[model samples]
Target: MKINKNIAISDSGFVFNPVNGESFSVNPIGAEIIDMMKTEKSYEEIHKTLISKYNADEATIEKDYFDFVGLLKQHNLIDNNEEA
Candidate 1:
């Protein structure tokens, strides 16, 4: 999935949707995922990178990644037309 171009994300994990005027805060890991998504990283690449950089296993990372993406989707933070 791709982050919507209009969404504003802060380095401190603050996310703002200008369209809806909705703001949210995420953890460090969630910030990293948002950064990677903004860079157009694929899910598999994100999963691999997280595994190599952190102590988490592949399965855990994969599950968390998808769950995060799902939340983004539910909140309309992602661009459904774009491939992530």
Candidate 2:
């Protein structure tokens, strides 16, 4: 999925959505996920990268990833026109 073009993110995990004037702070993993998404990384690529970098199992990662993406969708952080 792609982040909204108007959203701004920082290396320190701070995210700002200019469209809504909303800001958020994410955990390190979440930051990494957002960074990867900004690059238009596919789910498989993200899954493999997370699997190699983290100790979590595939099922756990899968669940968390989807949950996070859902949250992003709910918050309108992802571009609606983009395919996940």
Candidate 3:
């Protein structure tokens, strides 16, 4: 999924969605995952990267990624074209 143009994301993982008038903070891992999603990375690609970087198992990464994606969907931060 792609990040909404109205959203602002900082290197420190501070997220601001102007359209929704919402602001949130994320940890480093969440920031990394969100940045990857914004780049339009596929699930497989993101999964692989996270697995290598975090030394996480497939199942764990998959579950976490799904949750993260779900959050993006919930906030309507992602565009329809990028919906999974």
In model 3, pairs of residues that clash are: none
Task: Flag regions of model 2 displaced more than 4 Å.
Answer: 81-83
Best of the two (1, 2) by lDDT? 2
* Per-residue lDDT of candidate 2, residues 1-84 (tens digit): 788877788989999999999999999999999989888789999999999999999999999999999889889999767666
lDDT of 3 by residue, 1-84 (tens): 566767778999998988868888888998898888778778789888998888768898889888877787777777757766
Candidate 2 achieves a global lDDT of 0.90
Model 1's lDDT to the true fold? Answer: 0.87
Using lDDT, rank the candidates from best to worst: 2, 1, 3
Candidates, ranked, TM-score: 2, 1, 3
After superposing candidate 1, which stretches have Cα over 4 Å from the reference? 81-84
Model 1 residue pairs with clashes: none
Error of 1 at 18 (Å): 0.8
Poorly placed runs, candidate 3 (over 4 Å)? 80-82
